[model samples]
Target: MNPASPIRIQGIHYTLPEKQVGLEQLSAEGRLLSTPETMRDFGFGDCRVSSVPATVLASATVKALLERHGVEPGEVGLLINASVLPTSSLVPRGEALAEFPSGESAHLGLFRFSSTRIQDELGLINARTVGLSELGCVSLSHAVWLAHAVMLMEDLKYAVCVNADVFPDGIKREVVYNVCSDSACAVLLSRNPEGMHLKRYHTLTRGYYWDPDGHQNELLAAYFPTGKRVLEKTFKESGLAREDIKLLVPHNVSLRSWEILSRFTGIPLEKIYTENIRPKGHSVAADNWINLKDVIDRGLVSKGDHVMMFSFGLGAHWGCSIVQV
Candidate 1:
């Protein structure tokens, strides 16, 4: 395999609102789509839900990230919004958006353009805005991939990768099996290596599950087989074997799925971090990175240790990123 990319994750920050809901609470409230027992079997737990929209959550974290690193908004070369469930934005963030009202004009359907909104709201005047949709939970890491490519191609310095999610009212927090949570995360990427070393990113998708909202059965059937193939390829491309990886940073999905996946990928279950499965549930795009920060903080992934982050989006996107700490 070739040498890995030199891009670095300068800083990663995520935010979850104060509101929390437990599985039992949801069960009692009759808001869970799946029965409490089934959800618990998959990996039931409580999660933080935000009252604000997803865009607001994303913008708040991005602003905080800029302040934490002492980076000016003008220094941001690209702002990539990678969110699956973007809550509706009632107000326009830009001057041009005023021309089109909510129900008038052909601008946006219902979901807002969070990239430009964040840019305009935060005065990221010089930063070009972009978004990655339909990738579901995979879009977050894919944003890293896109950022790496853009910076390398455009000779840019700093790229802001943002992800956020919000489930509407009356919607079930559990999908398929993994529980859902509202959260936002921001990752500052740079060509300069001063922080988390981003080694390689690999992704695979099955279009058969493109419209999986009504086709949950087929999506479930395709998860393991397709996910295993991509994960094997991800490990291969990173030049790391099963035993070479010290840890597998997983998205906050189901423990049962990871149990079966360990047998397929040959990575032991002990290496897979699952402590957050109950605490945060599946934090959509924030899961892998959140788990990553936690494990690194606890000395689970040490210096020079090889680690892999794996995630499967609802739209049948399976991918992983292999990093050397």
Candidate 2:
């Protein structure tokens, strides 16, 4: 897994549904808290959605990837869904745990409603579903890492990684509104290099030190460190550093989170490629893939550009990948 090895990204597609939810509108719905103080603190403007169910975004994204790549759906060996909104209540405890700083009382109803819609619309079959719900902004990147791993182990010819979310309506809590948006992105992955090759990956996570008095450290411990550790190990195994990376894509949850991660990684803030947060706000799990597609579409990463991706969610789950153009 040499970082220098080239991985080609053949096709990337994303969907931003027509429906848009502004901060002002959410404020009216009592779902988004829009006090001046809160707005200044969180740096949230608005979010997006589709009139259709969240799962439709997933299906649409998958279809878009297939159409763009001119590949058939049956050719896909796996379908990995990285979403913040689950359509099914069957298994909500694992990755889809509900814990908001604003508490769950005000938001649970909306959550259940959207989750039901997601379950109803995404009657996806054939491909195994790797459900990642609560991972929030980092879900898509984690899916990408999983896609790469699957390519390494299985006889899979192609993998479809889909990320979609619809910021729940009737969310009366502003704290929950600003950073959440509705969007979907689909990426087609293959072992063959007729497209992009996945050269290497690095992930690192460290939490919960042995200390009796510092209970506050447990807060940071909420994030899963195993995936993060694997990312770092992969980087070391590949023998490369940030300097060799031409572009960096991170899960941009907020302005502050982006700044903190930039400081922690020592990657210049300017080198990071962020989505149109001011325009589209945060698209939850779809952020990473959408940003990757933006990079590809804007011609920001030319062929042979060394792109690095880092993503993590509340569980402190972190994943990183290095792909060569």
Candidate 3:
């Protein structure tokens, strides 16, 4: 039997506009979410939009992914946009070949690529969309798993996984105050060896609730675990113990969840990078790529290191994938 095609993360890039963060970057502007005055004072307006559109983010990330590995967009067999926000026409946008096209009005919609319409417009034959409403935080790794499955079961060569999510406007500061932030992440996944290859994939979900009366409760119930039993079941199912993971990127719901996971996994506090305290904040679905991007860009890992990822969404869903760098 032929072996599975090795899945590698070729290149990773992200854009966080400087002008985007108004008061959030200021020291004096800091305040707790419980205060309505602070919420009003801060410009946590409707979700943030990139200086570029959703497709721009996808295109830029794809371009970087290709250029870094000396590959071309045309060479990519599949393009998957797990982005919560897709272009208006829902068409493939990479065909434009330019980041910002000024005089291209009529062909604007043609270049946009929407994963939802991949199988219909193109003879993708097996293309499918994983909507953010259904995917939540686990979308990127889920796409990786699907692409791996396709490569193993089919004869596909390459797949591009793009994740772009913008926090919508009018979100109560108190709502996602601790754990949510705005950001975009894109990754090109393929069977190439220059990039880190996937060795195994594991997923676990444990039910968690914010109960004040239970003596271990605080914060609002922003999200719930998909299934109670599934959360603690990953350690044994993944075929490796928690100590085997050199790095872990989980959904950074809040400080409380971090503490809960640290206790549950028995991993060190320093190994977790999702507890972000900065202008970037906690990016939802983009957490995995963003964290991995930092690791790759900073030259933090060796060739044989293993990176474990955990993603949980609002649907009470959780996903985990182990990559060997």
lDDT by candidate, in order shown: 0.81, 0.60, 0.54
Count backbone overlaps in model 1.
1
Q: Rank by lDDT, highest first.
A: 1, 2, 3
Regions more than 4 Å wrong, model 1: 1-4, 86-112
lDDT (10s digit) by residue, model 1, range 1-325: 1265666788888898888898888877767778778888887678787777777888999999989998999999999988876342323444331222445544654445778889999999989988777888888899988888888779788999988887766777777777888888899987666577777788887777878787878777777888888888887777778888889999988888899988886778998998988888888888988888789889888878888999988777887998777
TM-score for each model: 0.91, 0.74, 0.70
Query: Which candidate has the top score in lDDT?
Result: 1
* Root-mean-square deviation (CA) per prediction: 3.5, 6.9, 7.6
Cα shift from native, residue 117, model 1 (Å)? 1.8
Query: For residues 91-208, could you state the per-residue lDDT of candidate 2 as single tens digits?
Result: 2222332323235554553344322343334433345556656554567766777776776567567777777765444543333324566677877777556666577655543344
Best by TM-score: 1
Answer with 2 or 3, whichever has the higher TM-score: 2
In model 3, which regions exceed 4 Å deviation?
1-5, 20-33, 36-49, 85-133, 171-179, 204-232, 275-277
